[model samples]
Target: MSRFQSKTLCRVGILAAMYVPLALFVGIQFGNVRLSFGSLPVVVGALLYGPLEAALVALVGELLKQLLTYGLTATTVLYLIPPMLRGLVIGAGAVWMWRRGKRLENCRTRCFAVCILAAVCTTIGNTLVNWLDSVLYGYYTFAYVFGDAVYRFGVGMLNAVVVATVAIPLVVLLRRQRVVQEVKRP
Candidate 1:
């Protein structure tokens, strides 16, 4: 691997390590809804590095966490969807905006846009997945699932707010600190 890739992977590894405890312990869960701080690292990695870094952190990290904590199960696969979507969508969106000159360093609106896009994508993807899992398991009727969807939607809004609030400043801070380096597009 090239030096840049190597550095990114190392950073991803570190982010993955940070993600587990924050996800399991720092996150808040109410019934089927969960607000996870774990995604913060993924978003940070994505905005700083790129989608690959974010995906590695989200996918590999969460996989390891699931394997270690709950072991293998059919349901374990379902857990991967949300984080992966968050990382990919957020990373790609931010990177796209940056490459298009909607730079995060000066534009708070662009930063907010990235956060909102990520949150919307994550919320929709996870909510669908949750609904599917319930249907597949015969856990609830369509009416009940609709009720659950409403609850999940509320939780998703909360999650979006938290992610945007935390990520934008952290991104700016990382840039100011020189901890986040912008990747050059070829």
Candidate 2:
């Protein structure tokens, strides 16, 4: 592998390793929402790398989370959608900004906006997944799923702001330290 590829994979592996514990243990519970800074590393990956790598981080991290938490139930794969969506969205946004000559480190407002958008998308995807899981496993009523979505959306957005707030400086530091190089998406 090329140096960039190896370095990227190493960073992705480290971030994915960081994600599981963050999601499983470091989260702040907002009732049923379970808000967490787990998204921090994934968003950082997105801003630093690109969509595919960040999505890999989300997928592997969430997959491990499911395996450890629920032991691979029927909804295991379904549950991974939200985090992957978050990664993909932020990554695409980073690419878009890069094309416009605006680095995520330099465009704080735009960076936060993209993060919020990704969070909203993740929240929506998560609600749909919950609805599907409820239907498939009879875990909860369909009505409850819809009702809880509003709360989830609010907490998710808040978590996005927190993740973005933290990720910006973190990415800046990574760039300054040359731990992660700036990526311009094609």
- The model with the greatest TM-score is 2
What lDDT, from 0 to 1, does candidate 1 have? 0.76
lDDT of 2 by residue, 69-158 (tens): 889788899989999999999999888888887786579988889899999999999888888888887777866889877778888889
Error of 1 at 84 (Å): 1.3
How many steric clashes between backbone atoms does each model show? 0, 0
TM-score of each: 0.84, 0.93
TM-score between candidate 1 and the true structure: 0.84
Q: Which 10 consecutive positions of candidate 1 have the poorest summed lDDT?
A: 103-112
lDDT per residue as tens, model 1, 40-155: 78878877776777888988788988898889977778878777887887778767767777655256666666666777777777767667878788785676566677677667
> Which regions of candidate 1 are displaced past 4 Å?
135-140
